[model samples]
Target: MSQHIQRSIDSPLRTGLNREQLWEDHDKGLIKCWEVGRQRAARFPELANQCLAGELPVLGWKGGVSRSLKKLEKFGSLKYLAQWQGLRGEDLNIDLSEERELTCSRTAMVVTFTPDRSKYFNQVAEA
Candidate 1:
């Protein structure tokens, strides 16, 4: 956990992205998700690294898009991280192993949804 926290401080996200602009571009579909993921990583490096390192599971819905997943996959645990780009309901989706729930407590974002809306995500978190 300390090392993960260190990585965030050591390698800060260099992109000069403004949150408002990022959201606008995201809404417009003009920005690639990977870049947004990078921004998230930069802004919240500790949480992002934690999720990537598998110290904790990070639940992502639309925010769990290819770009963010790709960015997060670099820290460690490729086995679980590799499934970030696949469609939902596929066997290749983010597998937490050992039937443990994939709950992302510290996320860059996208850990949204209620149990009623998505049982899959509810296991991740109640927020």
Candidate 2:
């Protein structure tokens, strides 16, 4: 008629360990984990969205998506830029450095590109 006993939080105090320090260390670890997740998502946002939407697993190198926004700037309006804008529902913000929106928009551009951007891709690839 007995249940398993657990050590009370004060047990650590009895052994001279500070509970406040333990909590602070635990919090820092959690913060680092969250930051890493954010960076991972930023790097491959379509993959993040696909994994979240249950479309696919978190494959870092998701095919046909995850193109860098930096590389995308090479395509001009004559080369399906309107298609990207319409598909992504946002303009390519060239000056963006570290903002999350830019990552999302850029990933959306890649996702929207792979299907019908052969002409543009060929043109860019040859140059």
lDDT of 1 by residue, 1-127 (tens): 1111011222333367676765454222122233334445556766456545543344343223223332232222222232222111112222222222343434433322221223342232223
- What is each predicted model's overall lDDT from 0 to 1? 0.32, 0.30
Error of 2 at 43 (Å): 0.8
TM-score for each predicted model, relative to the true structure: 0.26, 0.23
Top of the candidates by lDDT: 1
Candidate 2 lDDT at 117 equals 34
Best by TM-score: 1
Q: Would you list the clashing residue pairs of candidate 2?
A: none
Question: Per-residue alpha-carbon lDDT of model 2 for 1-127, expressed as tens digits?
Answer: 2222122211211234455643355232222222233445557667456544423121221223334445543222111221222123232222111111212233543332122234335443311
- Stretches of candidate 1 off by over 4 Å are 1-31, 55-125
